[model samples]
Target chain A: MAVPRELRQISDAVWELPVSWKPGMRVPARLYGTRDLVEHFDDGVFEQAANVATLPGIQKYSFCMPDGHWGYGFPIGGVAAFDPDEGVISPGGIGFDINCGMRLVATNLTCGEVEPHLHRLVDRLFERIPSGVGSTGFVKLDEDEFLDVVEQGSRWCLRNGYALPEDLELTEEQGCMEGADAAKVSHKAVQRGHNQIGTLGSGNHYLEVQVARKENIFNPGLARAFGITMPDQVVVMYHCGSRGFGHQVATDYLHVLLDVMERVYGIRIIDKELACAPFRSPQGQDYFSAMKCAVNMSFANRQVILHRVREVFSDVFGKSPDDLGIRQVYDVTHNTAKLEEHVIDGRRRRVLIHRKGSTRAFGPGMEGIPERYKPFGQPVIIGGSMETGSYLLAGVESGDQTFYSTAHGSGRVMSRHSARKKYQGKKLVREMQFRGIYVRTASLRGLAEEAGGAYKDIDAVARASELAGISTPVAKLTPIGNIKG
Target chain B: MPYTYLEEIAIADVAFEARADTREALFVEAGDALMNVMVEDLKSVRPLVRRSFHAQAEDLERLLFEYLQQFIFFKDAEQLLLRVSKVAITQETGVLGLTAEAAGEKIDPSRHDLNADVKAVTLHRFRVRNEPAGLIATVVLDI
Candidate 1:
């Protein structure tokens, strides 16, 4: 896709499309990436970002992070903030998998110690933490019990003996985001999510055991502060979300908003997927409350999965997780909308910030981060392809620009169908094994779809993120074993 | 019922275009496309269980959206894999109504070759188009 002729290079890695780029745009659209990254973005991203700019009450700019790619309405890796009183909230900006995020756990064991028992460990994690299509979690809950889980988030995990108190402390929003309203969620959502507590739902969702050698550390001091005390230390990372619960919530509301958006509110949306209601409206408030249920549901889901990770590791190592020093580094989400206070126009204003396929990288000393890491900023976990390496990053003061947002992962460059057509899952598995990365998957076709060639360069993405100053890399972690869904 | 996947969009999600001469046939084709996304081989699924769905919308677009969403709802809520075996579309008063009878069985991972889970049918590029010869519905399934 050709870069829009009017897109101006405002900075080394930033490009701005003025409001005039599209009709009815209330604000300009801003994209951040190195030149190569920007050039490789799908053609749909620019059009969708411009469309998002037209939404009512969008503030500053409709920002697309370095990893931005074509998504349904707003481009994935998009961020935007709007006034709660006058602005609108759109689910398309939040994604179907609400709070679909990343969690990293550090262990004292080194790669050498882990490599010997790595296969047994990976097999155990895959069995205990279910993956693939239609896989349900070991946790069973009736409708009433499910409601309690969503309302309390990870607190339910703590009560159920699935999580420690510090686990919640290291989590975003303490794993229990405020304002969840169980009454707002529908019975359909309850039915979809009731039994899915610890399972990892499919499509790019996975549990991987990774390793960070000494050379992978970009900022040793920050890494050590986060419990990566030993060279070649092993860690665990997984990505998933609210599963069927979030999808049902988003689907239910999209229908409600579509029926009422134009008819009741008279708001014009370029794409039906961007249909929204004014934040203060009854419909908007109802959707917001319901969305929070999914958010909390996701937090609880990850906490339970973390518990399973610990269980599997303990069983394989024949030692307790604490003995192995399995502590949470941090839990962060990429898909969400939260009410946050930022210095907008030199005044502190509470705005609803939507991050779709983008991570909130609150700078050092920013409100919302754990007190222990106050001087180092919030930990930002950006996952990469199963065949590539991932990154550990810290927010920077300069991140205030995109409302302290950063790229979520090595964003996709190829479509799944295209990648599937080009790669053989069986061969890819063998090739990966030869490269010292053990692999297991629930679906071979899915494995083909997620071939390494499908994604952008993670090293380049991390460098672009640092150069753009949204977040700075703390360390790089290579995948030693993978369990793909 | 004739439908072909439109090669996944830029993201990992899949899209398909379904067409037929009648709205009823369009429903069948679209429903088949949705089921096909989750199950690698539709032929592998047998009519071991049967279920019916009813949806009412003000327009064709919303009706199609609601109808397709039923399969995903059943897949998640009931652990059932289904295909539209029979369907009827009625236009009465101001409401567009659809009554569909679907048949499949409990998702047996051993029997039904499973693929990606279709999270929801997205509104992006969703359409029900009328033509001289027939009707066309373009749907995108978020995997």
Candidate 2:
């Protein structure tokens, strides 16, 4: 497909593809990217974004963050909100990873303090947090217990001694989502999730220890307010999602919606990847319920992982997590559909917001934010590729342009197979080592696939997003050591 | 013929890549390798019913993704062990294509050694490239 000639440049970092450019589109498509990045888009991304624009009740614009790329129904970094009454909910929009997201934990430990024990710390994390595919953690739960996780999320972790109440205060949505009905989830999904809590499921899921790089700190005042002191202060960041439970829920619902799309809804899709059912339909409700369960399950998973990390640190350093000043900076879900109130058509209305490969960057004073951080705005945790620098950002008022959403990560630039064909794990490891970054993976193949060169430049993407006012940079974190699943 | 497995970071280095000759064969081969990475032999179920499907994508890559997603859907939702039998593709345009196919069985716990469920086929590093020997595609599935 040729680049649509009607795409008008709104600014240095934004472009608008008018709804008239594509048939069936209900709204325009807004893309946040540099001139170079906009030109790099392939036909699939444009089509996917356009497809999103055509959805029944999408509002304002189908927005894509700087890291946008081709995805099933919506491009990665896509954000759209729909009227609860008229809009349709597509499982493809939330993605199978469910609440695949990132969490940042601030620590009092400086880089100098952790550098000496970086190897030991990573090894301990690798041991405590089971990684790789099919890796199970020590946590075990029965059906009812798992239901508690589904319904209560991080609160379940707190009750189970996996987390503290304070952690919940710092987590987005308070570490749980409402409307979770475990009964809606299949037995298989529950079974799959029972043993997987605290485990890092493979493929892009990882834990990293990072230090703030000097130059990328644009807001020193905000950083100081957030307790980010020295440039070498060490922090822990990890990204994962609801394990098998989320996969099963998405799988189960895709088929249900497929049947609904054909039999009851009378909707014909151009792509099965766009499988959906009317929001008011039985199948849609069931999926929404089950998906919430998966979302909560992810919160529980991350909570348990946090507990284990604390344990590892305590055991190794002979200090409690609190004594070490380890506390959750923030936890944010990237893939999810949630009910939110936004101004639509000059009036505030409740809508269902689906953000896939995107994060909610609610500005300060939003009622949904936790009290402690309400004045500062929501913390946005952006995970870059292993070799790139990740960032900690704060939501800004300017995000109203994008329904308060931002890109989730440094989007991929190359396919994994291509990376494997072009590079060797050993050689890549050596190169990372030369850059002063240490990486440990379950397989050499996994390491090569996550090579830094395989992803877009994180600095560029972060800058573009910040410049667009979707998210404001708070701190810049450069990885020193990491473990990948 | 047994399909070979190759891992690549194809699109933008965001996803994993797996390839096979036949559509069903590719799915089964990819399934085996993907499950193997997570656990062990998960496709040991006996061939049951042959289910036919017709999936359309804006392009071949999306078609292949829907193809793999269908197998995952069957395996997770219907508890069916689906092994692709045939795959036919007609490319209508640069990013549009139609795929038709048939798959093998119902999943039997006694026979099928189920492993990690694949969440979705991501476009992170997704690609489908034609080679002199055969057609090759790479996908990064969120498992």
Candidate 3:
């Protein structure tokens, strides 16, 4: 669809829709993208952004990043912060895959060293890490122990010998978020999560081995600080979430909010997908608490997988994990609502920031970041499609305008069915192999659905993010191997 | 058509319309449509494993929601990739209840050509309505 008629061009990379553009909008809607990207955006992006502006007690503006696309209620790259007292908590704002984020591990091994074993490494990694639909992980928790898994997050992983303590420190919220009450999560959700702790769920989820290219390093010093120092440095990136646990939590809460939204709060929503409850209401607090459990579960999930990744590298390279120096660079969640303090209108106030398919890009000196990362800012891991390659970026000062949030991935441009119709997964696999990227996948059809042509250009999306000044590129990593779930 | 996949929704998601002469048939067809999105062929699924599911909701629409969610729950929890074999719906005093039977086997990558692992059935444009022919259900799935 064409750009909204009333959208005002704020800059080359920013556009705004005045509150008057919609009847009940409490704030304006701001979207970040270059002209070409915005022009290619799905129609739902504008509709969802406009609907977000009308939510209760929205602060500043409803924002969409460069890779914005049509999601259920919010645009995929949508970011909106709400006042604690007057605003509402939306399940749609966080998405079904709660804490669906990226974890980057920097290894001392280089492409030159891994090239001979790239195929074997991919095979071993795929075999070691459970993935795809209905895949089960090594961790199985009973009722009581499951609570610890959700409540402790990566801390549980550390205690269970699944992660190093430093892994948690490099993770957002230190890998464990507060306010999680296992009792708040449904028994069904627990059942779904129990056997799936470390399994990577299907659909756009993957584990990729990549090589950092020196020419792509925009900020060499920053890259070095984040653990990348030389060209061809090998890194592993995993993209996943709380498995079925998070999906169930969102499903359960959406029903609750739908039942109470209009009657209890007298709130009107344009779409049922945007269902929510007042932040302080029992229903809202319960959902929030349950959501935190999913958030922590995801952290623990990735932490366990990180350990498995380390094991595979050690086994393949014949070096101890410690000797390999396969340290976690960072882990950042893109789909979540965190209670944070951001300065708005010259006032520092606590707000619930909802980042649906948007990564947290807190700039240097942000209060919540770790002491070591304070100087270089938080590392934002943006995973592109298998073909386009990914990037390691750092939050920049200007990002405060978007509440320190940025694009999460190269958003899809074609439907799965369309991609399947146009491309063959086996052929694509061969193509990737010919290009020197080994691939292991569960389903050929599923693989075809993620054809590179189906997504926006990762380079262009990253450029728009930098031009918009929300985040600055640090280093680019090209994939050497990939495993798809 | 009992059901036809719709193409207007976002590229990352799957949307489809299910229709039948009765709500029960519509519900059955809807479940089948959901399963078809994941597997290349529904007939390939054997009835070696069977499950019984019961759901109740304030209305028919919500009942459909609960039914579809059960399919996803089973897929994740039991590793059962099922097809709705039978569906019976009862409506009384504005409440709708459903009893359904699903039959299939575990998802085997070697045996089954999987397309997508549907995360959940979303409420985005989700609805059931009566039409000239009978009833129609429209659903957008998060895959």
Error of 3 at A311 (Å): 0.7
lDDT of 2 by residue, A299-322 (tens): 999999999888988887889888
lDDT of 3 at A436: 89
The 10-residue segment of model 2 chain A with minimum total lDDT is A265-274
TM-score of chain B of 3: 0.96
RMSD in Å for all candidates: 1.2, 7.0, 1.1
Ranking by DockQ: 3, 1, 2
In model 1, which regions exceed 4 Å deviation?
B8-10
What C-alpha lDDT does candidate 1 achieve relative to the native structure?
0.91
DockQ of every predicted complex: 0.73, 0.20, 0.76
Write one digit per residue (lDDT tens) for candidate 1, span A1-485: 79889989988888999999899999999999998898888888899999999988899999999988988788999999999988999999999999999999999899999999989998888788888887889988888999999999999999999999999999999998888999998888899899888888888898889999899999999998888888899999999999999999998898788789989999989998897999999989999999999999999999999999999999999999999999999999989989999999899999999999999999999889999989999999999999988999999999989999999999988887888889988999999999988988888888888888999999888898899899999999999899987
The better-scoring model by lDDT among 2 and 3 is 3
What is the RMSD, in Å, between candidate 2 and the native fold over all Cα? 7.0
Instruction: Write down the worst ten-residue block by lDDT for model 3 chain A.
Output: A135-144
Report the C-alpha displacement of residue A270, candidate 1, in angstroms.
Answer: 1.1
